[model samples]
Structure formats: structure tokens, C-alpha cells
Target: MAVEEVFYKLYNNILIETNLQNTNYDAVVLIAYPEDLNVQLPRHIGSFLEKAAKVDKHITKAVTVWNCDYVSGGRLVISPTGKVTPYHDVSVVKQAAQKGVLRALEAGAKSPLVVVQSVVHFPDAQLVAVLGVLEALYTPLQMRERVAPKNFTKIGFHAEETLDEKFERIVRNAIALERARIITRDIGGSDPERMAPGKIVEYINNSFSGENNITVKVVDDENVIAEQYPLLAAVNRAATRVDRHKARVVEIEYKPSDLSRVIETLILVGKGVTYDTGGADIKIQGKMAGMARDKCGAAAVAGFLKACSILKPPHLKVIGVLCLCRNSVGSDSYVADELLVSSSGKTVRVTNTDAEGRLAMADALFKMSETAGKELNPHIYTIATLTGHARACYGNYVAAMDNHSARATNHSNKLQLSGSRVSEGVEVSVVRHEDLAINEGKCKGDDLVQYDTGAKARNHQLAAGFLIKVGGLEEKNLKYTHLDIAGAAGEAPSEPSAVPVLSLCHLHKVFM
Candidate 1:
């Protein structure tokens, strides 16, 4: 017999032994009483019987015997054929309930199963909070497809209590993150000429309009992002439709309610290269594949912003910056050995087309620092899937964090002030331009192999150095950090990871 049939048989037997009057054997109900109950049955055996009953609709009455007294309780389905699945633990129970329904549908079960786990002795407040979070999570996971498209644009709270509010916030954040992934995957590799950043900004603005206080700003002035930032423009020039396309910076800001508690503003910068083809210095074979995931860093930042909007820390402001464009092969693409000037007016000699993430980030970081200077000059954090060196160093489990020296010192001091032990050996890496090298093939007809020896060996640090150059922040004016998240952003064949998002959320909680 099948698993469901076996469950039904066991459930029916338990119901007959327990003196339950139901003969149909379509469902079973089991009661969990305190240890002092005057029952001769083994606890584990009784629990197992209850679980079996939930597998098939075989029994339907649950009577609790506490101490020497018997109390009549509400009925809980042990076996929900189609609508629900019974669970002992609320967390697992919620997951099981949904999964059981799906499984029944797949198995072509005729009846609707509804699994219910009723808490008999637990505190009402805690139970309610737990149930509320589960309900919020359930709505998005089960009904995302059923919800109208217009509902995606508005923001609403799932639960009302402040103590349990974060749970609902996190659920919404996770949903938005999933939605962003879907949007990005769907729009991937579309004609860059036809799809503009303004369109994306409009979509986001429209979809998330009323619910959360989110402001999406699209910087369309190609020169605003391009003219001085040659390194960024260099890769973009390779696109066949560069003239028809405008490089854009998309900024999403979320501000908190109170000004006094706002300890610091957090700025998240993401490398938004929608598509990357190793330009004139083209990637050969294996290297060019999966370039579509180049924008994962930007996706993470967008995800972080969505999370912030939902979480809404009382005194934290989050600014998400996405530098979006496509790097394709075209006549305007900067060839090997081209010198490009950054927004900070620092000239960078382009050595490789694939090192385009840093180029886009250079201008974005500069603009962010400039903008912050006019405001509160908040602590800034830039995250990007910028280098293979970071992957080699951290292996996708953790992002390489590079903090300004002063900020590191200050953080250590704060730890000490709080009576916490601060490790002396901990250090943050900073990349410098001197670390970068360009191999322009061979000069003239010289057969001797020319090596760019002076170029920086620490690839990750050099990338950070370039951003600092453009950010124009003095050592004293700002606390800045760069997170190289190449390995953390994508899943490997062996395992899946959401390192960047998890790390950002953790950091947000700390600073908020």
C-alpha cells in the first residue's frame, strides 16, 4: 500500500483503541497532555500515533487528561488529506502544513487536507506572535503568484504588534528579494538599446509606491556618469548601441522616523553592469560565460534596500546606489592601453576589460561621498562582485571587508569601551592603484615577454583604493568600507549561498 494508505490504517486503529466514535477513518485527532496525566501510554508512542493520524483522515477527537482531570478540547485534524498536515512544533508545522497540501495535489488526492496544531497550554501572546510571523511568511510563499501585480507596488504591515513586527518585516524583505531576482533574471540579456534604466526606475516606483517610503532616483545624464569616468565609459563604448543607450545611476533612499537616534547613514553601492562582455580585451571561451551575473552585487544592494524599507530602523537611513549599464563589443569600446579619467579626475590606465566593475563603482562612490558631504556625511559601505581575488581569499563564505583606518580604530575603541575584547591582529585591507597592472600584449616586435611588475599584487585592495580616490573623503571626514563580494553573491555548483544579503542585513542591524 502507499504511504497515505498505511497512515490511514494506523490512524483508524489508534481511533478505535482510543474509544473515538468516528468510524469513517478519514482523519484522526491526538491530544498532548502534561506528564502528570494518569495515562499508561508511552509519550513517544502516543506522539507517533498522532503523527500517523495526521497523514490520513482517520480520527477526529482530541481530549486532554491533565493530572487526574479530563478536559474537552477543540478538534485538530491528524491527517489532512488535502488542506493541511499536523505538526507538533509550530515552525515545522507551518512548513509541513503547506508542503502537505502541495504533496496531496501532486499525488492526486481527492480530499482537501487541513492540518492544524493547536497550542493547549502555551502563553497566548507568544503563540500569537509566532503564528503571526508564520502567517506573513505563508502569504508571500504560497500566494505570490495569486496576488495582483498592483499589490506588489504597495507596502503594508502583516502584524500590528511592535514586539513581533520585525518578523513580518523580514518576511517582506525576503519576498522583495525574491521578486528582484525574478525581475533581473527575466530582463537579463534583453536588448540594452531598447531597455533604459528609467524604465526600471519607473517600474520600481510604481510597484512599491504607497506601502514603503521609497524614493527611486534615476540619473540619466550620460555625461553625469560618463564624461569624467572614462574607465566606466570605456567598457560601455563596446556596446553596439552605446549612442542609443544612456548609462544611469539608480538611487533608492529609505529614511527613518526620528532624527536624534539616527547614529549614522549607511550607503550601499552596487556594481550594476546589466551585461558584461570582456570588451576589446575580450574574454576567451570559459571566462566570458555567466557575465550576466555581473550585476549580482547591485541586486544584493537592491535587496538590502528593500529589506531596510520593510525593517524601518528608527534612526537609520539607507541609500542604495546601482550603477547600471551594459559592456558589449562595439567600435567605441576602449581598446587595450587606453587611459581613462575618473570623476575625481584621477587618470587610470585600463589594462583589462573584465575589470569593469571597479570602473563603474569609481564614479558611483565619488557621487555618493559628494552627496553625503552635503548631508550628515554618513558612514559608507560599498559592496560589489568586483574581483576573483576576494573569491580566492574568502571562498564565497564571507566577504573581504576593508575599512578606513580611523574607522577600524574607532570601532576597536568602542568595543573596548563596552568591556569587550578587541583583537589586535585584526586588520582591514585597502587597495591602491599602484597594485594594478595592465598587460597590453607585447610592445612592438619584441619577443621577450613583458611583465607589469609594479602593478599591485593585492587585487582587492587596489579596487578599494580606486574607489577611495574617487570618493574624495579625507581620513577624518568619513568612515568608509569596501566589501569585495564576488564569491558571496553567486551560488557554486556544490552549494548555494546568500552571503552578501545576509552580511548586509546583519550589518544594517548592528548600525541601525
Candidate 2:
């Protein structure tokens, strides 16, 4: 499918309403602070809430449905953002909006009007409120293609007391961000067979078929992968036995039309492990059930590139590399203690076969590191759901570790600032001398150890160090950030969270 048919046609169904007077909508989802419930609402709605609050003190704490005459279908959803404190952030607004939308869906309201009483403290409160609505409205790609195609007939957005020009701009920006997120959710949240390496190449090729300023290239030849990316090939050895599951390196590039406007370049490498069987050190105790989400890092890159294509921000060139592979177990599966030469010619000794995410993306990251010098002020990023340690360290927050060059400029802090603007939480972790030292090989034969077995602290940070060393980026003086989304990639039985996409987009000002 072409660009319009693939992304725009499927996702561009949000209707911008002029005001709350539109009676065509079946329900009105009001997301507001608990204290402002009786202030900014319609006269009848406000009167109803004023009376309801006296009888039911707990009405403001959770999602409540009231029968009112102010809107169509006489259904009103009062989803309140609980008491805001100094420690509270914008996520409370997003969560309330989502809960409000879910209540509307449950009430069979195909057309729900979402109204956000945005707080002054949170600058992106309105945009994030709308995103939460879209998150709840999203139907899985497989479900849309096979089961029910329509999640909602139309979603309506109403911003109180905002200018038409400014509201239009916000809606446009929200649409672009949600569209990009749909691509990530489609790839990251789909089943293993549906998003296998070969099929991922096909899906990406089809998505960007007729898009402007976007180019896609795939490297699928097994021999070529073995010759050029030996580290990646080692992980791909068993997957080659099955044609559909074979590895693929999908490179998507987006360069602004005016090269004169380009001031910097971003090289992103993603770990697209479609299904992580753990190779020889197989994940027992039923830990492998949800491994399909392991490719979220690659999925995030694809989604970030999608945002770039939509926003078309000037003064920046973006490159996304998806290292697609399945770490399956077979007779040929590379095991622990096996030595493999990385693309940068670093000999890496594998200490744990389950540590395949870094190996899968190391060669591609090295290749990008080799050419980063030619680009204007290039920054490289490796995004992956790499370690359980990250999840253990920070609950549902993406951990970011920066190389020395990135730390020199406080890149992680900049990212943290942007993440705070949006609702995505980013925790910064430092890659210390101890982290780098932990990855050194035991014997003198190898230049690096794939996984640290003796380390007790900073497992997630150490993983970043391994990637930096194996990619040969340490000596290049290039800025690199490793994002471990193991905690933020969404838990099982839920849609992928698509964390760093929104954060990265905001940091680069790609929000239309």
C-alpha cells in the first residue's frame, strides 16, 4: 500500500469539533481536574455535577457516568484527573483521558467528544490528553485487517477557549504523532509470525512505497549478512533454516530536501529481535512467552522515522536501521564462549546467549559509527528492550545511558527535559569506568566480553558499554545514547508502550 492508504487512510479519522455544542456525538468525555468540575462545564452539566458531588463524595476519584441532557445520547463521562500535587506530572491528565475514552467505548459511544481542561503547569497537557484518547482507540493491526476494522466511527476533540488557528495546529501535530505511534504499535505489538524478519521488511517496504523524501533498502542475503555483519549473522544462524524467519537489515533514510538547512544527522540502530528463544541458553520457566515484544527498539526507530517523514523538520537528516533477527535454538545456534568478530573487527566472546539484542545491533551500529564523521554533527542511538535489570531498576520508565561524548554535551539531560514535556518518563543512567571495565574479556584472546557474568550492579548500563565497545564508537568521539526500554515496552497482554518515540520526537522538535 502507498503512504496515504497505509498510514493516513487507516489512522486519520479524528474529527476536530468547533465546540461542545455539537450534538451529533453520542457522548462527552470531560477530562478535568477534580476541583474544576463545577467551574468550566456547561450550565446544566455543571449543575448536575454540583448536585452529584454533594451526594457522592467519591465521584471525583474514579470514572463516573451520569445521565445528563447537555449532550447527545444523554451520556456524560466524568473522568477526573485526581488531586495534582507538586510531585505529580502531566501523566495524570493523560491517564484520565484514557480512562474517560475507555468508559465511552464501553458505553457503545462510537462518536465521543473529548474535552481537556488543561492545566497551566503542563505545557503539552492538551496534546497528551488527545494522545491518550488515541491510545485507547487504537485497534491492533491484525484485528483491523482481519476482525473489526472500525474502532470508532469518529473521534472529536474540543479545546476550551483556544483559537481556531492554534487548535488546528495542535490537532495536526497530534495526528502526526499518533500516526507514527500506530506504525510502532503495529510492528511492536503484533504476533511473532506476523512480524517476522522477512515479513517486517515487506511491511516496511509497503508502508513507504510512495512516500516523499523517504527511501528504504533491505539486506536479506544470508551470505552478505555473514560476510559483512558476522556478529549479527551469528545470531541469525538458526533463523536462516526457516525462510520466513530469516534475518533482514532494513535501512530507512530521510534527508531534508535542502541540504543547506541540514545542521545535524541522527543515526538510529534498533534491535528487532522478532522472537527471542534465548538460543542455547534458552529462557525456561515460561519466560519466553512474551518475547515477541523484544523488537520494540527497532519498532521505535521505525516509528521515529515515520514522525520525521510526517513533520519534515528542517536542519536535520535521519537514518533508521532495523537489525531484524530471531534468536532461535537449533544445532547451528551460536552458544556461550563462542567468539565472533564484529563489523569493527573486535573479537567478542559470548558469555550468555540470551544477551542477543546487543549482538543483533552491534554491527549495524558500528557501520553507522564509521560514517558518522562525514555527517554534520551526527548523534547515534541504539534503542532496545535489552535487559530485565532495567525493568527491575525502574518500573515502566525507559533508562538512557550515554557515552562519554554524549555526556560531554549533557545529551541525556536534554532528552530528560523533552520527555518531561510529554508524559514519557526517561531515567538517566551513567556508563561509568566500572561499566566499561566489567565488559572486558577474561582471557587475552578476546577484545571484549559479550555479557558480564561477574557484575552485580548496573547491568543495564553495562549493556550500553558493551555496545559502545563492540561498535568501536569509543574512539570516534561521536555522541551515542543507549535507550533500554525493557521496562517501558509495555507488559504482556497489552499494546506496546512505544516510549522513546514521543520523547525523541519532542527532543528534536519534530512535533509539527
Candidate 3:
């Protein structure tokens, strides 16, 4: 059975308790008494009327309200067929009034009207509950789509009151975000030819536009590409034979209604390698099987942009940077040990072809920081399915985070303060400037004893440290955090864990 079907079955009682009974009405509304009220007559009467309307089909309106000795008031309407429809209770009086007006307009002269006598004061909890119910009722009806015979809807709530309210909105939006992600992945996997890179961009734009007001920009700069992203070009050499593997940088921006109030800006970057064949330094058979899923980080960032656009927190501007390309082997592909210069003019020695994700991100990080320095002065973060060492460190539950100051030199101190110990079997260590530079071949402590060797057994920690160097970010004004999500990007047997989506949302909330 499908996930929603199973969910419905599990929550049968709760569904029924919400007054969602079997009926021929295309839509139904459940009304409850205000919590601060002291009377029970209105609820009792409404239940009886609801049962009678189910059999007669003439009663179109039903109203349940709280009645107390201190206060009393209620509203109800019924159609010519005796089908009863409930209207505003003490809670959500405005929304209930608006819905009632609409229902009356639809019913015309055949509407049945009933007012329940009650004595109850309006309560804050009732207003919140009623608003929640109304939001749930309108979303499905408003956002309905005819995609694949399934029910797809957009749900929104006014969550500006409290943290719990905001959290509820996040959870609801996250579900929709995950569903969209699954649909995108399934479509890409099933119809590889149809879901090309351009099509993927179109899909993202359309999907996100349906629920948000964000604009997507596709950036193409040959100068920037050659200067900062040579590794991306090298990795796509094979695909260039079929068609020049066009490198794309997707930028999504969320601007506020009043620009003057904007305080802080955040730029989120993702490495988007649609496919990875490991180039000349080929992966083992089993390891190469799931290379198609390498673009999951891009999907997560896309989802985050969609969510942030909809949530629209105050005074925060967010940008999503997606560096998209493919890694394939060909005559022109770079070989192992080839030293490639980044856009920042930093040399990266390609010891392993599988490390292509970081190469794509290196350019994205450099461009984002450069652009930030000029235009936005934003904090930068790059997420990618980059290193297995991250999986080894944090497992699938949490992503490994490397938080450093904007300047490269501050990385040494940040690493130390963050409890990052030197990896075993790696000669190149991230040394403090005050201690000694690795090029000088000098160390304050035992450096040679910690170095290790071999392909699979090589030092992944050193690999991570190297990527930071290539990005050339200053630690003082720039705060860079790299999320290596190699293990969290794919589906698991237990659940569809879109881990990075939630993490990105949380990060945006906290820092932005």
C-alpha cells in the first residue's frame, strides 16, 4: 500500500474524532466548542443534526459550539436537501464568517439556516484550532493538481505567533518538499533521456514557482569556468564528445517586500554532478553502481530554496548556488596526479577521480564568496555528497560540518577549537601560521608518525583540508561551513530520509 494509505489507516480514530464522518458531501467542516466555554448543549445538538443530515441528504449545514451559563451564541446553515454545513464558532469568528458567506452564495435560496443557542466566551486555543482546521480545509481544494491521478496540494498556515506554530509550518512544508524531491528523482531515473540537465532546470523552476515567489537564474561564464572550475571541465571531458557538457550555476534569490529592512544575507551552495563514472581512477564495481544519485545534494538545495521562499522569514535574504556538471571518462579526461588550478589560482592535485564533487564545489564556493564580497556580503555554505570520511565520522543521521572563519589562515585555529584532530597517515596537516607551514616541511610535534597510505586507506581528512585551501576564503569576514552528505543523500530501507533538506532549513532559520 502507499504511504498515505497506511498513514490514514493508522490514524483512523483521530480522523473520526475530528468529525470527519462518511457522507456524500464533497467537503466537510468540523466545528468544536471553545475551550474556555462551560456549556455542552451546542456540541450535543450539532452531533444529532450531523447524523440526521447524513441519512436525509437535505441538511446542508451543521454548527457545534461551546455553551456556558455565562455566555451563549452559535451559527449554522443547511441546504435545501437537508445537508448541514457548519459555520464560525467563537474561535476563528472571522474566517468562519467568511466561509459562511461563501457557502450562502453557493446555496442561493435553498439554504437551510440554524442558530444554536449557547453561552460561551471565545478562547485563544479555539481560535488557533479553528484557523488550523480552516487552513487544512482550503489547501487541498486550492492547490489540487491532476498529476498522475494523485492528490497534490499546497498547505499554508499563519505561523507568526509562536515557535510551535512556526515549527508546525516547517514540518508541513518539509513533507511537500520531500514529496517533490522523490518525484523529481523518480522521473530522472525512469526517463534518463527526457530528464536532461535543461529539463531538470525547467522542472525545478516550475515546481518551486508553484508554491513560492523565487526567480531561478542559470549562470554561464566561460571566463569564470576556466579560471575557477577547470576540474569541472576535466571531469566532463567524456560527456563533451556527445554534447559540450554545459556547466551551469543555478542561483535562487529570496527578496523581501521592503529591501531596506534586510539585515543579513546567506548564500547556500551545492555540488551538482548528475553522474560520476570515477574517470581514470575507476571505482570498484560495487562502489560505482549508484553514481547516478550524485546530484542529490543539488536536489536538497533546490528543496531548501523552495521552502525558504515560501516561509519568507523577516529581514533575511537567501541565495541557493547549484554547480551542475557530470564526471565521465574520455581521451581528454584528467588523469590521476594531474595538478589543476582553481578559479582562485590555487593548485589541486587530483589523487582520486572520485573526489570530483569537491572540485565542482571549489569553484562554486569561490564564486559565491567573490560575489558576496562585491554585492551581498553574505555568509557562505557549500553542501555536497563529497567525502565518505564524513559518513565514517557522523554516520547517516548527522552530516559532518567543517566550520571555519572567512580567512584561510583562521581555518587552522577553527579546526583546532572545533576538536578536529589530525587524521592518521596524512603528511600534509592543516597547521597554524604561528606553528609552521606544511611547505616548509617543519612541525611543532610528531607529524611524520601520523601519515598513512593507499587508495581506499588514504587520509580523507587531508582531502577535506585541501578543499578549503582551494576555495581561498578569508576566515575573518567569511564564515564557511562544508556539509559532506555522502551517506545521507540516498534512500534507506527504513524511510525516505531527505536529511539535508531539514538541516538546510534549520540552518537558514538559525543563521539567516
Top candidate, metric lDDT: 2
lDDT tens digits by residue: candidate 1, 321-343: 87777777777777656656666
Clashes of each: 29, 0, 39
Segments in model 3 whose C-alpha atoms lie over 4 Å from true places: 1-17, 20-195, 208-213, 220-224, 374-377, 406-460, 492-496, 510-512
Q: Give the TM-score of candidate 2.
A: 0.96
1-512, model 3: which lDDT tens digit per residue? 22111111111211112222212112322232333444343334556554655675434333322221211112233312111124333324324433542353344312112222123343233222322232222212112232221221211222222235433443344343344334324322322233444556666666655444477887556456665567676666566555435566678877766767677777888877777778777777578766666676676677566556656666677788877777777787767656666677655556567677877777777777777775454667676777676566555533433435543444323432222111101011232332112211122332111111242532344444544555665353676656556665654222223345544444345212
The CA lDDT of each predicted structure is 0.48, 0.86, 0.48
Q: Please report, as a residue range, the 10-residue window in candidate 3 with the lowest summed lDDT.
A: 419-428
User: TM-scores of all models?
Assistant: 0.60, 0.96, 0.58
- Tell me which of candidates 1 and 2 scores higher on TM-score: 2
All candidates: CA RMSD in angstroms? 12.5, 2.0, 14.0
| Candidate 1 weakest ten by summed lDDT | 417-426
- The residue ranges of model 2 lying beyond 4 angstroms of the native Cα positions read 2-12, 36-44, 161-163
Off by over 4 Å in 1: 1-199, 228-230, 240-245, 406-457, 473-476, 491-499, 510-512
Q: Using TM-score, rank the candidates from best to worst.
A: 2, 1, 3
